[model samples]
Target: MDPSGLPDFHGLPDSPVPSGAHDSPSLSALDRRIAGCRACPRLVDWREEVARTKRAAFADWTYWGRPVPGFGPPDARLLIIGLAPAAHGGNRTGRMFTGDRSGDVLYEALYDVGLASQPTSTHSGDGLELHGVRITSPVHCAPPANKPTPAERDTCRPWLIQELRLLRPTVRAALVLGAFGWQAALPAFAEAGWTVPRPRPAFAHGTRVTLPATDGGDDLHLFGCFHVSQRNTFTGKLTPAMLREVLRTAAEAAGAPTRK
Candidate 1:
């Protein structure tokens, strides 16, 4: 562990499999490997720089300073894919969708739909839980200006692909937030053994696509929803009710039980 008490990942390979982590076939191992990645030089510098020069609001906190891993169970039936971690949100808390307005909107909707145990995700050990869902992103590192370059996105694709391959056995549905996530997830799905359509589906709010599994498993139902960014939520683009409805539909498609 480093001075921050987190695992030390200095000099680790950017990709996990190439570093001999493939031998450990478990989500936990994959997560550790992901946390140790230093693949994109730009992302590495930005995330660490933010960690060192802490935000005023989070000045007392010890930033994660590493790639954020997917949250929820390994056997989750539903997967929610977002673009990437927020600079001060996941990058600080070390958990996806935590400590930000976007997370507030997301977890609230998940709680309303019976997928999340709590409506607030303040920290990693806040007892938050997802019943049958896993939340992840194509780019695990927090990028500058809330955007990653296309090359950086490609460099991060392997991690998502590996994650999909691990989750393929049980993941029955995916809800992608935003066009970036939709674009990133489709190719990863195809690489992970799903049969994407000849002409890839376009992304739009409430768009749904069904992908057949090549391994003869259950079909993967893909859904799209507007990202829970403040810009979208505050502008009346993606309201609470709208987000909840998409969550409910995706949860049901995954055969995941929901109270509402």
Candidate 2:
């Protein structure tokens, strides 16, 4: 771990870092570091440019324009993984899946299944909370055209790796939003001492993969769900009921109690 808060995790091992380790920062501290990262020049330029060029619909709003961190309680039992932040969505609101149509769909389903406190996530301090699940993306910074380059994705890997290490203690199940998220999570889990499948598990709706845990942790239950993007939602590929079912199943697998 880098004390200076650079993306350099050169000497850190793959296993979970002890909770109160002196040299390394905690999850909250790491999140601050993630927001301040300029390691990828391309990403920094793009996100800032988007912020500067205000969207017509959001001309009165101030954009956060930085890397968004995972949202939810630190002791969550489930993790929700997404691909990357949308330009005007997370880039504007500074919270993953917030102020976007995708978030509207996702949070609504999460609420329906008793995972999210509210049915919408409009801003950072909108009083919205996730019950037993935390949400994160493989790429923290919003990318151009909603697509992050291969180099950018690899450069951002260490952040996700570090986050997984911190969350490993309480995270017993994971709900991956799409193929990209599934692929991104596999390496992070493997690096965190979870035994991923040899050939890699194929991505499909409702797919489940149980990973045997190392480091004295419990086995991780993996669930696959289609992303809550408008492309899928409008086309009827991923419906509200479909997403709710998957989320509820993940919560059940993790033994998470429902508030609803």
Candidate 3:
């Protein structure tokens, strides 16, 4: 164990076989790559600065200070898409929806709807598990002002596309957390050659849309909802029940079995 008593995987002895000899590419590996990425130098520098100076209120906390990566079961069919990482939230936790007020209500609703194993999201090592759901974002790296430009969003779409293609989920339903996520994903599908419907509607608390698959076969269903950010939850704009109902409807539309 390391000084913190956490398992020291980084200090393991070399194995007989090569590192990639018997391993298969997985979401965990993808996450690691994203964590080390410096694709956007501005974001890289800004995130690191926040990590170094703005420590959490809790003394024991250590900022993740890396690009937050997608997290959940590998074969999860439902996808929860958010706008971008928050400076003090995912940017500090190295995992989506951790270490922020936004996560408190989100995880609580997920736990209530059987998507997560725990309700409180304090840190990455909190033993939380997701069932049949994966949380991702339009932009993996946190922007300086929490708003990525259209070009930046475009630049990041390929990564998300790669993730979706690798997972090959049978029923893909996006829980778009805000207008930005919806805007980013729509053009992505179109560029993939999917003929999307016109007049993309504004995001609301619970709105759903269906689109033709960009692959020229199958269909992709998309759901829109207000982001469970501190702004929304703290202002009573999005209640836990409202979020839960949106998730339930999305799950049903995707044809996934309801949690017991």
Please, what is the whole-model Cα lDDT of each candidate in the order they appear? Answer: 0.88, 0.82, 0.72
- What are the clash counts of all predictions, listed in order? 0, 0, 0
What tens digits encode model 2's per-residue C-alpha lDDT throughout 73-179?
88889989999988888888878898899999999988888888889888886788788889999898898888888787877778887887888888899999998
Compare candidates 1 and 3 on lDDT and give the better one.
Answer: 1
lDDT of 1: 0.88
What lDDT would candidate 3 get against the real structure? 0.72
Rank ordering of all candidates by lDDT, starting from the highest: 1, 2, 3
lDDT of 2 at 122: 84
Write out the backbone clash pairs for model 2: none
Instruction: By TM-score, rank the candidates, best first.
Output: 1, 2, 3
Best by lDDT: 1
User: Who wins the TM-score comparison?
Assistant: 1
61-149: candidate 1 lDDT, tens digit per residue: 88997899899999999999999999889998888988899999999999988999988988886778899999999999999999999
Looking at candidate 3, what is the lDDT of residue 178?
86
| lDDT of candidate 1 at residue 59, scale 0 to 100 | 78
